[model samples]
Target: MTTRTFTNRLTRALRERALSLVDTGRPEGLVFLGAAAGTEIAKATGFGPLEKVCKPVIAPSALVVALRDGELGAVDTALLSATGAAYTVGDVILMLGGGHASRSVARLASGAAAFGVGHVALGALMLRSGIRPKALQMSFHGAVAGTVGGMLLREDRGNWPLATYGGMLAALSALATSVDHGRAPSASVLAVGGPVFLLSDGLILARRKVAGGSLAARALDVGVIDTYATATLLLLTGTAAAARSARGR
Candidate 1:
């Protein structure tokens, strides 16, 4: 398809997907147990988190392929640090600030850190495999990272967004390099976007779970939205980026 057509389709698809995720978040709100407590939760809340979590999401592999057509991201941006340190780089280190710092990365070094780091790692993988962040890749990468981060980290601890997202972006920069062809993506993005995405996902789903009256049953409610919404956001971002790229092309 022509770039314009692809852009139009992607735009429409994203709008639709956004609506879908929003809609999916609703049923829980209607019967929300917090309003009535436990009894209301069992009988009233129809959509359990599991039901929300199980829904399938479309993967935008093509956008990643387009990114490969350009150049390696590392040439212009570096994913790794100079002396094998993760936080030394300008961008990565900057994540220490309070703003988005909640999405901090933890490794053998960070210890007991959030898994959002994995999503960032995957971002590098996709880029290296020649996957462009155009629109789909970026959004999906970010969303997944955010979802995973929320799941793993819960100390209410905050870290640097730069190190986390910065690392992922560095990976995207490296992907532009193409050291290996089509390497399977790492789950790092799940680690990076965790804090941000979780906050958003929980805000949307948690209310419903509480209202549905079964806080325990819906404890994973935010996860339900994260499972699909995060992936969709990544695809949408990639699609939008692709659209912009096509314009330049």
Candidate 2:
């Protein structure tokens, strides 16, 4: 082969390799690896149920593999939400195991950060779909304000009402955004998952406020956890399917 042709092929190969590296280093991989490492550390220390950490992390990692050949699209939001969920669940696990208060705070903060980012991701999706960007932006603004106000109230007065309502509204807004845009069917999956998540989270918050330990609270807790897990699974898998299908088109 001619030297120029050889050089061209070599450059193309290198470019592909770089792209592969970039894909592997995305949020899904980073989150999975970080969680895996943390779980290992926690196990070594005899801290908690490491299996609980593994289950949720597996879905995102699998999604990264499934969508490796295409653009991630709004799946980025799903991955992030999954990561947040991992932290939230981990916080519960830590608390149940009587872990440190500081650690619990850190986990809760991670979940909060995820909630904030999910709104921005939804806005970006709306823009891409050529939907009502202005309306979506307004929704995003309201969501952010609600989140901030709710966090402040929780911190200052230990009130959870605002936070619960804010979360429910954000979830509904996400559903509406996904449903309004006809760009992809994966979004439809998101639409369904949103309300399921909202319902589960709302029930969990209600149980918390009820000063539980009753049989009803215990049953509700079990249902919420299962429902939330189902929602997360739906989101992660839907995102992967969306990315793959989007690329196919």
Candidate 3:
């Protein structure tokens, strides 16, 4: 065969292989696609503009989840998504009301606290339903990392409150992770969702510490992380509900 023909064949083979890897129904493929889409969306909207659009984009994911899970399954799923929406709105408020830094911080802190509460509630529900998570070590480590990162990124005037909220969020996330261990469909969802949630928060904090005009800072500050985090959370809750429903049948 000619060299050009051989090269073309090789390229096509490689492309097909890559596409196959990414097109699977597995959790890994979902994560890969989610992250890639998130990155592109972040770039397109720009950080500030993205926040304004986040709530609308995320609401539909929750609705689809509710529909798939059914009325009984929708309860927890709806609660989870509602709390997430509240948090997103709070974040947007903080971003828009930039002139009132202290008030904005307070609003953000309140939202974080609410989100943390939701995590704790979800963990409790999982435990009540007899799901025993096997990843305490992972959860603990995540909590520690979140605490340190929160402290490092604490705002100047609102340091104490913001750090406290950050620590709370981290702790709640760890609890949720621990509760997600042995569950079926939801377990897989949380496996990826939990870490991405942490990444989203960490990036938000990091952006606050960096220069606003820089590319890294803009990326960090974008709604993409929040969008991805919320979407994964919906997936986690929805899958868990679906799993329970399937088992009940």
Choose the strongest candidate by lDDT: 3
The TM-score that candidate 3 achieves is 0.61
Predicted candidate 2 versus true structure: per-residue lDDT over 30-80, tens digit per residue: 554455455444533444566356534643553453355356655554654
By TM-score rank, best first, the candidates go 3, 2, 1
Model 2 gets an lDDT of: 0.47
TM-scores for the candidates: 0.28, 0.48, 0.61
- Which residue pairs show backbone clashes in model 3? none
Output the lDDT of residue 115, model 3.
58
lDDT of 1 at 67: 36
Candidate 3 per-residue lDDT, tens place, 1-249, comes to 554654454355335423533555433444434544554465445544544444334433443333343444555555545554654455455545541122356665765665555556555545544545457645675667666655656535455666665565555455444533334433334433555666666666555556555766556645445544454444345345534744565
Q: Highest TM-score among the candidates is held by which one?
A: 3
Per-residue lDDT of model 1, residues 1-249, tens digit only: 455654455456446533533343543322221212332232235433322222211122212222332443442123211111221222132222211112333322232122234345444444443455445444654565565455434533343442344345433433332222122122222222333433433343234324343544344443433433343234223423333333344
61 in model 2: Cα distance from truth in Å? 5.9
- Give the number of colliding residue pairs in candidate 2: 0
Give me the displacement of residue 239 in model 2, in angstroms: 4.0
